[model samples]
Target: MGVVNVTPDSFSDGGHWFDTTAAIKHGLGLEAEGADLVDVGGESTRPGASRVDEAEELRRVIPVVRGLASEGVTVSVDTMRARVAEQAVAVGAALVNDVSGGLADPDMVPVVAAAGVPFVVMHWRGFSESMNSRAVYGDVVTEVVEELRARMEAVIDGGVSPEKLVIDPGLGFAKNGVQDLALLAGLPRLGELGRPLLVAASRKRFLGHVLAGEGTPPPPARERDAATAAVSALSAHAGAWAVRVHAVRPTADAVRVARAVEGAA
Candidate 1:
């Protein structure tokens, strides 16, 4: 999966594709680079970011989703709004990648259930503004896995088909580097959730911290693509069903190598 953030404040590549035409072209570019699916998100979920009004979000997202879908792209609408998800699906979004895992919006599960599209339920603590404060966990892996399981059950109970659900650990949403690394190491435990795993560790803060040694500043977001590709390779090797990334080609190459190793195994 390739990421197309259509907001002005996404952590990475925000303003780059804020334009409808540019966003569509970028999605096609990702497809050409070997992305199986392209994810379009309007809201900026970066830490400490404030929520954009629903109208603005719709304005930023729908046109791009429609444009990409028109060109035969398998698009996923990355949103927490039920109305947005519903409209995007109607406009040809094949999946709903809800960062809040249906928690932020009351109608999100119902909308996804009604649409009958695949849903990416991500592990989340709260809204971006207050999320970091809620990152506390006894054992990050155990807690995340348990929480994700509960969410999956809730979503299933809410009328969504079990087979249509996928799970994401949400590497940087509310987690610090230690916790994020723990989750990566614990991918096998996450796989026990009985659903496909979507690893979305592209250009996240944790990777930046890892790349930057202690007492040093990390590189800019765009410069983290190689690190993201490394995480993608590791995640795929560890049985991740897919990886959402900003740079598709390098990660795609790494994933192909991992898949080849898996085939050999």
Candidate 2:
């Protein structure tokens, strides 16, 4: 999966692809770069960002989703809003990549289930403005797993087929640098949820912290591509079904090589 943030405030690439034309072009580029799916998000879920209303979000994303989906690119709407998901799916999006895991909006789970498209439930708490402050956890992996387990049960009970669901650990959402590292180290544990796992560690702040602590301040987003590829390799080796990335080609290549090497071993 490759990320195409149509919002002006995404944590990593905010404002870079907010224009419809630029976003569509970027989506095509990602597809050409070997992304199986392109995730188009209208709102910025970056820590401490303000929320965008449904109308504005729709205006930003539906056309792009429709354009990409019509071109045979699998598009996932990175929204926690049910209305946006429904409209996007109707416009041709094939999946809903909800960062809030259906917690932000009351109608999201039912909407995705009713749409019968693949739904990505990312672990999160509250809105982006408040999530960073809510990062307290006693045994982060256990708590996240249990929380996701409960969410899975809710979605299943709400009528979503298990086959159409995927879980994401949300590497940087509410986690501090140490917690992010812990989640990556414990990636395989999420497999206990009995769902495919999608890891999003691309150019996140924690990786920057890691690089910076090792030497100078971490490089910028574009410069973090190699580290992102390394993270993709690690996640794929640990059995992640997919990795959400900004730089698709490198991560795609790294994952392929990692899988091939591991399989040969």
TM-score of each: 0.98, 0.97
Tens digit of lDDT per residue, candidate 1, span 169-240? 999888988999999999999999999999998898888888999988989999999999999999987889
Displacement of residue 23 (Cα, Å) in model 2 is: 0.8
Q: After superposition, how far is residue 216 of candidate 1 from its true place, in Å?
A: 1.0
Q: Model 2, 81: alpha-carbon shift in Å?
A: 0.7
Q: Which numbered prediction scores highest in TM-score against the true structure? A: 1
> lDDT per residue, candidate 2, 1-265, as tens digits?
9999998887788999988989999999999999999999999887888988889999999989988998899999999889999999999998899988888888988898889999888888778788888899999999999988988888888889999889999888888989999999998899888899999999988888877776678777677888899999999998899999999989988988988898899
lDDT of each: 0.94, 0.90
